[model samples]
Target: MELDKMDENEWRYHGEGNKSLVVSHVQLSIVLRLLKYPAEDSENPPQTVEQAFRQVQNIVDFSSNVMSCLLGEKFVHSGEVVKLPLEFVRQLSIKVQHQRPAWRCDKVMDIYSGCALCLPNLTSPTLHQPTHTPTLCIEIKPKCGFLPYSKHVSQDIKTKVCRFCMHQHYKVAMGTWKRRSRYCPLDLFSGNRQRMHFAIRQLIDEPQNNLKIFKGGRCIFSSMDGIEDSMDLNSLLHHLRPYFQYGNNRINSHMTSKALLTDFIQVVVNALLSAGGGDGGVGTDRRGEGRSFCEASLFNKERSRHGSQGSPSDSVLYRVRQTQMLDTLDIEGLYPLYRRVEQHLQDFPKERTRLQMDGPYNEAFLEKLHKCPSEDDGSLEYAVSKVHQYRVAMTAKDSQIMVALVPSCEEEEDDEGLPGQRQHRDFLSSRPPAFSYSVSILDLDPKPFDNIPRQLRLDQNIVSCYLRSSCALP
Candidate 1:
């Protein structure tokens, strides 16, 4: 008998006895990486399989402990399964599926087994009569792990809320709003005046969205329209101030409020332009009618008196930049970023009344102020190019990281140079020396090997016996 072939009990006992057989440290590290757990030096490391299993048990125990703490109830362990009292399993299952498919599978299997094995024992009925006992069977299959226990709860609570808040806070601190929003904290609310003031200073110090709008295809306005655009333009300017205030309130201050505001405004303007027309014109301009009206309206009797004698009669030339294609692309990119920013702003906390006052606001802060949409560049090609470049860089980085993480393979092969040399020598030596062609070998035709059908012969024997039986009966 093969020594490797062991009984179930023997295998189980052997596996239990060997502490190293339960889990490998490398496997544990892989699991941690898959789970995205932060690496800490103090964390226990697994060297053997048993140690690994113990570590897994510890994880399960911790999970159970957390559940107990949150639910205020001890988990009842029946056999192999530890029934979770809390309703977070469904949500946990979704997180696991997204982040740790393998760990989730193993964990679920362990829990199910624990539940089954931990059941309380009870006496059976008579031998002839069957005892009606509740049997809880947990099936462990590769595909079965995807089944979510609490689907309704998982779908109800939005998981992106916290992430949105964090991102919004970062943007607000960085003052990216100079290009993004319509109102600042000073204009919107009165509380935390100092905070907002300080934030504005920080935003002015680090203005990122200045060139971003030009890249985003904002249209530059003539000096005349620039004056008329001040009303709506100031609205966006005001909206960005609060984000600057909030961002400056943070400790690290990685982002400035103006940058966040700029990013946001770019999104809004792009959206407005997208919805109104491909050129970001609000529907006021229908075909050429609106343009004609604006031109005619601007060149009224009084304005015409100021013009030179007989300047093209009454026809007014409306100079609208041809940006239909560029506007479409800008809007497409702007909408997603806008939605993300909006979601983040919506989730931001409303606790702080006003921003704190920090450094003095100077020319730098004033310089950070972005020109309104009217002053934007005509094309968004630069922005599009930047986006594409960022995506390419990220893809390259991911590929490099994956390559580095994966193990390399090595294999041996025969020396082709030596084989080629041997072949060359044999050909050179045998060229004219082996010219003896044998007639006997040329006339030889090998016999074909016969393959008999064993099944056919057996059938023939059965047929003969059947015929003999049939004749005797007749």
Candidate 2:
């Protein structure tokens, strides 16, 4: 049985084509470079296999370096040497011998390069033997039962076909069976399917600690699909679990208050949608969001003074804290939601639309007045109201939401004595209020900010007032 028999003729042709040859050359060159060979020889002619291999290696090394610079520090692991299979070498030797009469050295090099690139993913542990053996080996005779005889259909051909083993006879003559079903020593005693299944089970049961193991490894006996799916899902859940817990935690951690968590989630969702243009670089999407989420949580430890009289003006910082929390908690949902929202916006009407308020306390509202449709039902109004409600709820529980928003000495204390418990001496030492302002939201026309800055300012002022008033209430 031949390898070509198993794969489609087109794929086999592609594997033997010029592109495959170039990739092979690049791969071979990379391997040679890894072995510390002097790849360039200005004085030497390029006829020899050794010289050609060296030249290819040099090109691959140069390409790898360029790619590394453009991408990052470790875009390509150039040092790793890939071993060629003895069977591949043998096949190349046969082709070289057959084509030697007509093909020039350069043509042969091209073929060699293509063969290298076309080599399937290597199985591990790679045969590390010093002798360069072909990855596959086969022996053939004209009289062999599996060999194609005549173009005409005849009774003698049937007898000859049956003489060879059932697998090889049917596959070689008809070209319709497991092509790799060779009469090799390995295949003779062992069933390939059983061996493959065992290998896959072992890999599944005992996966590699490092994910890089999958690179250039054999697919046979490896539950790569299953493992990859599980890993990705696990990663998604692991990053998102904390945000949900933080949002729901009754005794909130200083760095991840409920209000801040909600804000962080909103920012993350917005960032995923590429909405509200901002330098969201580190907090932009899944990968960036993860990094920013962790960093923000760490930074909030210092900013969330954790106790004492809250500072209301530190709302901006509080909002930042919320953005951080949201980025971490809803990262999983953010990507999916962003995709859904983008699709929704594309399909949603551009004409006049209505707003609907629903959900917890009927506080959530949809604001379709914006140029684009909202991705999620929660609009700016609902978001602001949610933040205000969260703040009020925390305050009512005797927790200082303002203190958690700002960095201050007084806010650092874990416990502030009850109203009647504080000594008169302590009261005397307290400083006077620095400044104050009320916050609320006001309705304004949905027009671009370019024409009416004053209107926008008023609208903003109204929104702040509304939020502050909502926070102030029972």
The best candidate in terms of TM-score: 2
lDDT of each: 0.21, 0.24
Model 1: per-residue Cα lDDT over 97-181, one tens digit each? 3222121222221211111111111111011111121111100000000011122213211111111122233344455343322
Model 1 worst lDDT window (10 residues): 400-409
Please report the candidate that would top lDDT against the real structure. Answer: 2
TM per candidate:
0.14, 0.17
Q: Model 2 shows how many backbone clashes?
A: 35
lDDT by residue for model 2 over 102-157, one digit each (tens)? 21122322323222322212211122222232221100110111111222222232
- Candidate 2 has an lDDT of 0.24
Candidate 1's clash total is 76
